[model samples]
Target: MRPFKKIAGIAMSLALTAAMILPAGVRAEDTATDAPKIVISVGDEQKTPEFKADETKDLEISLKNQGIADAVKVRIAPVIEDANTWPFVVEDMNYERTVETITAGNEVMVKWEGLAVRPEVESKYYKLPFKITYEDGEGKQFQLDRYVFVKAVAADKPEEKPEEPKPEENGEPEGGEAGFSNSDPVVSGGGGGSESGKDAVPRVIVTGFNTDPGAVNAGSDFKLIIHLKNTSTKTAVSNMLFDLQAPSSGTEAAAEAPAFLPSSGSSSIYLDYIPAGGTQDISIALNARADLVQKPYSIAMTMKYEDSNATQYESSSSLAIPVKQAARFEFSELEIAPEAVAVGEEANITCSLYNTGRIKLYNVKAKFQGDGIEGKDVFVGNVDSGATGSIDGIVTATQEMAPDQKCKMIVSYEDESGKASTVEKEFSLTITPEQAPMDMSQMVDMPAEKGFPVLPVVIGAVVVVAAIVILIIVLKRRKKKKESVEEEDLLDEVDRFTEDE
Candidate 1:
């Protein structure tokens, strides 16, 4: 009994470890409309390509540019931080591959010469984060983090499930078994744990899961339906109880509060029976914590059930569900410099953009539209949550606008899922008509307009005449002085002659 307890503890530990290491598919955030979006695909249904252990496999990764611009100077590298998390290692410890460019509406296939999986690697879905850095056609630098899902399977993992005996020989009618059809793939003992040695113990696992609304937002209640299956073909199981929780590392923040909690105050779910190769579904209401970060969280299920012999067995499985924070924002009142303008003139428009929600606004832009004005798109770039951005643009008047005209300022943005959202704000703009040019012939015959500098010209002439009169009087006085000096000299000469006689 103690050995059985030890085995169950080992199984639970492995499940939690795998949950912490595995990655949910991807958030698939949208790039700017003019930028390139590169994604890797290897033609797997789950986006997970299978690799065998202890093999140096050659991988061909299809990198597709999903935007209108070309991705230039593209560099891709695999980020491996832990040996326990990643089953594959880089070749020659060089993790990077460079590409010249990938044009729009096309794809480039890159080959990895050697990607060696560890000899002791377990069978599971392993997503390795690939860092891609590139520039858009307009020379804007961008960095993207994409995960490549690599499904690592131990050499002895496959083909054993299909080789089991058919369940129809156990008195179950044919075609009536569609309730738990064998066609749907089930996970009995492939990842994290295996029941291969315990052939008598029936293994049950979670096949698939989905939420009601499909989009689960943080700080909201949602219904989660988990599809489970009994993989044992010959044994009928009954008296089952399942316990669910979101596995967290022993960090201070995680230990303080769980990311997800049960809405009904209990995480235990009970079920009666699932016949051989049968399936069951368990639905529960859950509330995502308000403070949970925007990411995919893993949920671990500890399933305890019984076999036909009343022998109780315990197994664990996990699945990751993505939760998103709602994107919210608001605009301040539009401020238009010179609210009124004439045709062919320009007006500057601006507004304050605030991110009011927890989600970041990607590629934020504002555009102005009206009958008489031509405005370019105002790019505000990415606005983090609780941050502010500015929307500014100069719009030129193209033609005369109608009276009491109302113009629209449209703001556009995208969420992580590539969903576009727009907001329209209306403001009044006054545009006067363009004036006609005056003809030169009409100006020639036209008299000067009223008050056309008549007083200024009269004062100018009076000052000029006064200066000329003063100059004439000064010249006459200088001539009289010269004659008086000559008369004095003649008198002096006559006096000298009288003295000599």
Candidate 2:
């Protein structure tokens, strides 16, 4: 009993001392002369602070010594309790800024820049908690915390109208992923009271889609556009990648994947980033297979993205596209400019290549081949559906070619798939033997088969005989004259000698 009484008495006395000392401590802290007034602003504008998502803004904080005495070694800093839940990012500003002393009734201002908002978040007000730590004149340290409200809105599209409000809720909040209560709105990025768990992830939803041409033609190229919306209010999504697949399942035609052309060297596209509540557009160029049935075809789209913390997520979408049938071709006429040509001579070949199918033919080319012929390839380029195009070529007959020969004309064309096909047509060629050069000596006895001219040859022979006879007569006259001159010289020499004697 004595020990119990002593213990009770000591407890009561200690309680009395605590009650008195706590009041003194509270009074010391409450004294107006020991504290300073502090204010925080965003630049010169301090009222109704607001900023857009993904924008960096500057912060200005001021400290005033409202006490009766100067405060020594004064220091202050701002802190955020929960960064993931807060709408803004706080940077370190105290390391480079400190006041040695703040005189009584004087004030000091501090500025910290580069505070940004999370992207893709809807317009809303955010409550951010901050802390300020400083010392009084008598070396008494004090710490305080407060909340600052900032409005964050979208940065672009001023003309856009706000979404309509839904009717009042009557039932329990809709269910969500595990660890989340049905009562709270689904917030994918913000770290609220109930959403602060580490497992919180972002979700991306498909809004809508469209195709460049409402209907596609078999063996044709078209474009596809897909729209996406980020449903996570607090998180910015990134590394957006998608895999576009044509339905290849179940039926025989479905067993093969749809034919998709690559864009920018790859079929899959990477968007890299999408802000919260923002929309993204993806465009892809594709080609429908030529053999596809004339009906709607299904395309499967798979999307993968990451949140602010680099957590990956996936979703899927589907679409049915319409297709039309392919084109056809027919050729009816084949003609050569001349019926006959001599060996080693050139002749023109013409053909009418008609498009009999419903579609056009592209890159039409024609080539000729024969046993002994030099043929040229012709290009008709493009022939419209139900239209006719002329394919002309020049070919030379070789020396080995016979009087009657067979030649082949090959017409090649490409389909929408870029596959090449050829059609071959056979035609008869009448070749004449090459004419032999004229010979004057053999002209008179030559056969008519040779087609040699005889009148010119006879005239040439008569001229030659007349020239030979005239030449012989002139030679004889020259010999007679020479003999006469010799005789006269001898007689003159004899007369001169007699006169001298």
Candidate 3:
């Protein structure tokens, strides 16, 4: 019985030793009460990688159970290394294993979907460390640490492009683009302000003008007419005035001044509101002086006016007129008397001088010049512009003059313009002699000289002479008859007596 008890105790001891000498991995939990039986790892063992400014990526953690039993109630917490000091943002965080019950020979994956890595933190790299806690079926907790590493990579900075230049105006390059230094006057000449180039202010133009009477005698009244226009993009205004002056050598006289009217005449016409592209007309009158010259004179017309903003503008024009001499003198016919007067006897002759030039002829002189005779001088007084004066004078023939004599008469006078001139005319006269008379009886006895035929006188003379003759004959016959009768009585006693006898 004692021998059989020893063999049973040894066998029990050997069995006890075998149980105490089990494998270290299977006995690890019993040897250390706080040691974890499982360890967790990530796909990447280095620092977490950086993401681009607009990029997104996913992160994953993998776990395996290498122990003798299963792992239960596993929890994982992800921590950012230096995240509070960096400018990175974690947009999302997700876990694939919610309540993982990992078996000893199995593996699990913890996936983070749509997990964003913050773009370019203050530092170049970023790190994410993970800690996992789990419990075995014995109710003891185990902890594991894992990490990830990343680098910034300064994501490829893109290349920049340059800008292009603009073209210049006037077909020329601007600034240094022309590749030449600009120092010439033609290239740089310009006036400052709004008139710099093609942009400039416009001007008003005067298109037309006119005047009247044109021609006038000295001292006569006349009128002056004017025309004005506004040829511009703006309105125009002006005042009209005229000046009349005589020639240098003539009278120093001017026309009478003119009166002012509202929109016409010498007065200032406020053409203040002439619209763009419109026109207006103006006219005036003036009287010339009496003493003006007998030649041409000048008239200068001018216009002055103000703009809408009270700016003044002016323009001018000149014209000429002729002055003529006034008429004052007239004439009659030349006369001479006693055409047959003897040369020794004063051959009487007479002629008249008439004033014909303007203005009275003061101290007028007249004389005759010829071969056979000497002339006497005649004088007259003022004759006025339209008035007439005359001179009656005689001229005698010389003692040596023959039957007929001729002479030239010259007249001189002064005009109103202080000028003098001469005019000439002609005259003639004749010379002859005289005789005496005698008695009545002889004149009566002589036969009368024959003259131009007088019909009644001749007829009467013939009749008287015939009657006398007849009477004489009758007397004679009667006497003779008486004698014969007496004789006849003797002879009648003889003849009538002859016949009777």
Task: Report the number of clashing residue pairs per model.
Answer: 0, 6, 27
**Candidate 1 clashing pairs, residues 3+ apart or interchain:** none
TM-score between model 2 and native: 0.28
Ranking by lDDT: 1, 2, 3
lDDT (tens digit, per residue) of candidate 2 on 311-337: 566676655565655556666666664
Off by over 4 Å in 2: 1-327, 400-404, 437-501
The global C-alpha lDDT for each of the candidates, from Candidate 1 onward, is 0.67, 0.60, 0.47
Instruction: Report the alpha-carbon TM-score of model 3 versus the true structure.
Output: 0.28
Runs of candidate 3 with Cα error greater than 4 angstroms are 1-302, 305-322, 326-328, 345-358, 399-406, 431-501
Model 1, range 229-282, lDDT digits (tens) per residue?
888887777888889876542224655566678999999999999998999999
* Reference-based TM-score, model 1: 0.47
Candidate 3 lDDT trough over 10 residues, lowest sum: 178-187
Between candidates 1 and 3, which one is better according to lDDT? 1
